[model samples]
Target: MSSVGDLGKVKRVETDVVKCKSCGGTMVFDPATQSLKCEHCGNTEVLSRDTNVLERDILEGFEKAARFDRGEQASFKCSNCGAVVMLGADESAAVCPFCSTPIIVKEEYFGGLKPQVILPFKFSADAASDFAKRWAKRRLFAPRKFKKTLSPENMHGVYEPAFTFDSKTRSTYRGRVGDRHTRVVGSGKNRHTETYIVYRNVSGTFDKFFDDVLVANNSNFDQKKLSSLLPFALNEQCVYEKKFLSGYMSEVYQKDVKDGWTDAKKIIDANLYSAIKSTLHCDVVDYLDISTEHSDVKYKYILLPVYFSNYRYNKKDYNLMINGSNGKTSGKTPISPWRVLFAVLIGVALLALFIYLYSFAE
Candidate 1:
């Protein structure tokens, strides 16, 4: 949890206001129309979709210190949850998506790098909450009340930071590969087929192009749960526009570009290995060594939309994430202890019945 002293040092940055052309009321991005909608006048302003989203040179990014904060935000420290989040300057007080604690906006945390592209939300909070309820219904061990009482008010739309790396790789690899084969080594009564691996030295040059391999840069959320929200329509991303961020909050990238590259390289290496193995067409690889040279490496800092909700059950917090682009949901829910106990009792009864049958047979 954040200390009162820590919160005292925080300051708020003024945000640019987007007003409705008709009523002059505050306007927010409406996902359904892909435009800015006025809360008071019910008017909508269409944002241009002519996005020229570009990838920056990876080597160039390495030459500079990578920053995560974009200066257009106000910082808030959640005293109850210890979550430091950036909210739009206009948003004075908001709830922490991680622990559902109210946070008071204060200072600017850091002047971070601006995202190159954004995938805006396609669904509303009510839709995301409905998806969550339907998803909860599918869990056999979930409590019934959880499904009945899950509310849309608990879910909020937030933008998550990620890095998408594109690269053209050339690799030279050498390895010993083996193919399994069987042969009869004995005759007559002693005849038996023995399996042997036929090994051969292999060397090859492999080239592959990797596009938009995404790696999340946030440490606050569950990595596996975040991954389950994938297959985002990343191709439909738009150039960074403040209009898109009217009402939503975004996470500052915690992993720097260099560290992000390291993660991207790990993904590339695995893909390279698969490509090399496919070229060799070997049943088993004994040992493989590869040296890769990457050229035309490009990366883009991107924001993906998600509807986030956190719930606490049995003194533990569970997170639910809905893909803002497609409404696909993933989350952790509370398990019913009574259901688990009943399952254990039934298992014991089955075991006892099997033992009684075995005794009669004996």
Candidate 2:
């Protein structure tokens, strides 16, 4: 079935939010204040955390499920690099932004449920900028221009959507088990020979509850790279409140629960396999295949917070991420060509000096 998000004219419409009526001006989420504050209007709008709870569970056949995009997003396809791009509100999208490919947001169909929870901007533009600067400083190999020019103006706090899941699993399996031991064959030679015997049958029931089995809503960012900057203060996360999105740049879910749930299940199943293996706790095994079934599954749609920025240096794109909830940071950085060349030259010169000194000693 088509979702409500997919039916709209794909072009995302930026809505004009009203200021806190008490104070007449733009109201936005303030990280330091941890509340919505109006700068021009001086309206103090407070956010309340709902007492409602979210469910986390493993959905059946998560990997095999439909992978589709559904929400208000402009899909950018880069013919130069075969990269598809998406932009958010805080993003000062100039081009491919990362690859410098000229980008234009065009509306399109998105087939996903709206997020139920959101962790608002606890980290602001200034915070993100400072974080980026410190991050560049730590990167010893990063190009000077890339770090200096890649200002916070290039940074944006984007609310990326994701699904977290939990599950109970029962797995049945039959495989060969191997135990390693060495036996002395000849007393005179003292030679040792290794032997193996396979154990036939294995079956077990395993259960584990997963919290925040996350599947990303954004496709532009690599999942592994994104996960490196994790633990998005999900516990403090509240139900999706638009008031949080005010004055910030963020993207709605392009990937829905149905599709995201599929990704979530793969994560759960891997955990399930680990749980089952942990339950077994055996030394060695061969030809292992296990099938699992899931039950009592529940899911929550959440908009997790993230700060994203990408820089292009020496014709390669470097993406950086910051955890929006806490100040934790993670991502890949580009090394400067000059730095590498200079190091190599110094090493070569040292080697030449060492050879000359060795010749004199000889």
Candidate 3:
């Protein structure tokens, strides 16, 4: 993470390239176990972390996002895998999909907008495949052949883009809350009586400050899927530096700053309302009428690491993802009913054999 030249104190980079000397396969970020793993063949390498970093004004980052042009994955060679590649308008692949090597070469000027901070990948490709296997093993209904055929080579490490926002807000709210209690009334057969009381004339000003609310700067990744890759260690974030992008392919922030900020505000408002409503100290939660206004909104654009894999089973394809920083794994795997049945049958056979042996001994 040491600063070099114009990258200043805010830039962080992997000092050494993770390579598999045996196969020369580029090491990729793996979400499971948080390590640098070579997927072509099972190999793991050590990576050190330097947490010194900086923060950006979330709003300004968004404004710049407005002036930026959408960048395409033009002809470029991968530093990790040595692939001279081209991609569709939507794709932002970091490595060569065929060779399983990192291929994304840094652009001198990637659409004019530069990343403010980065979440360097800690996990390697081999670890990501292991994560996939562990994840696959739990799928009781998944196909056995597909499980065995699950290839780690199908996975790629892509740098997903996002904008984190910080803001101060004040909201005016009016809401109703209710609590239920029952009373027993009656004969030999017990009957329950329910009572209702309404809350009215509720109004208050809710003010809360948000430090880091996330917004997807890229449209490709699903919010649910993207959110699975959390705990970005924003504390380790540094200012915009090109060195970090040297050997990795990065995605341009597709969603403009306005959209990102709006998204961030929405997330913040939802949490803020929940906080305010809970702070009201009501036993039951209900009808909420709240309006929020944003002030002093700030933001940062970042490239976070992830291991992505796609597999086909039963004519359907599944995408699996792992968090590059901490190895938190998420993705759908094919289920096999045969495997489940076989496992159950084996258990039953073992029990029967044990009983027969006991009888013979007697």
Candidate 4:
């Protein structure tokens, strides 16, 4: 609830360095043990898996949400891809995880709402790379060399930004729906079955409470790709802590709270339409107009784990995104034109043979 000017006076950046009690070495959050492990010595420290996540009221967030530009931490922006990333305090130089461009420690001011909760990475970078490799192998059209040339060492762990909203909605809808019916239309040889639609006017009131409608806050991470990596185990999210961000780069959110809520509403409206249609139990829908009122709206700004790898084949570049919490992967891969041509030829040959056999039978 602090204003940007009020909080900007404190210029101390929050550091992610958690020193080991046994050894003086730096410790990082290790997914293998779900704890902080010392890099020098093999000492592990358990972190409290706090599940008491808070959702701020939409009105309150608009007025008094904490802004990151208050100077609590510094971020680095990539000149090549325009990605803003936050790094550990001790780190001075890092490569842009998205584009593999070398970036220096540039203390740039980032203005946005600080994350309220974080879903730490559940797997290591090596595991994410393995997931990407398996996913690429399943691409039927992908070139063979592209699959074999995938480098796991290029994988980078990043905490992607997102917004999840909860809302109670009441909707009044009016529409006309139709159901199909088959009937005998004629007599003898002319008698044939014809399909007709029975239309009826329907109107109803629907009341529903939607929880955890997530919208991606980064422009580079599109909604389609984010949806493909669904079921992020949001129940396991922990309260935002600097320690959770250790050993990983967190992307600054590109979309604001207002824009994020707008996107969330679109998702909610689609869902509402489907629910209403299902309740009507109609085969086809002619028209439906729904007027919805959203109340008691709440939202949470959170971060999710993702691994990205950019690979170049020939003169073009292909990218892969792996879900750090789960093993789900989505990305583009180079396709083999020769393989596609061979499949087309086989299809044509099969069709010609089938026609020749039918003519011979006649």
Candidate with maximal TM-score: 1
Model 4 local distance difference test score: 0.77
Poorly placed runs, candidate 1 (over 4 Å): 1-7, 66-112, 185-191, 221-225, 341-362
lDDT of 3 by residue, 1-362 (tens): 11123322221211234567678765664434445567678787545544554455655564565433324323444454554445434333344445545533334334546666777766556767777778777777777665665465655667777877777898998888766556667757676676665554467998888887777766667567788777666665555444344235566667777777777777887798779878776667668788898887777777787777877877898877877666677877776767778899999999999999999999
- Give the residue spans of candidate 2 off by over 4 A: 1-14, 56-112, 183-201, 345-362
Ranking by lDDT: 4, 1, 3, 2
Q: Model 4, poorest ten-residue lDDT window?
A: 1-10
Candidate 4 lDDT by residue in tens digits, 244-308: 76667666666667778899999999999999999999999999999999999999888888888
Candidate 1: what lDDT?
0.76
On residues 93-161, what C-alpha lDDT tens digit does candidate 1 reach at each position? 344567654332332434445667989888788888888888888887888766765677877877777
- Worst window of 10 by summed lDDT in candidate 3: 1-10
Q: Each candidate: what lDDT?
A: 0.76, 0.62, 0.64, 0.77
Q: Put down candidate 2 lDDT per residue, 1-362, tens digits, no spaces.
A: 01122323443422334356775555667877878787676778777867476664434334324434434344444433545455443221223434433322222232224457887777676788788778778887877877775566777666676666666566776555565556657666786676665455666555566656777766754467557877677778777666766555555555545766677778777776666665565667765677877667667767666777877876777777888888677777887788989989999999999999999999
| TM-scores for the candidates | 0.80, 0.73, 0.72, 0.80
For candidate 2, the clash count comes to 14
Report the Cα lDDT for residue 62, model 1.
Answer: 81
> What is the RMSD of candidate 2?
8.3
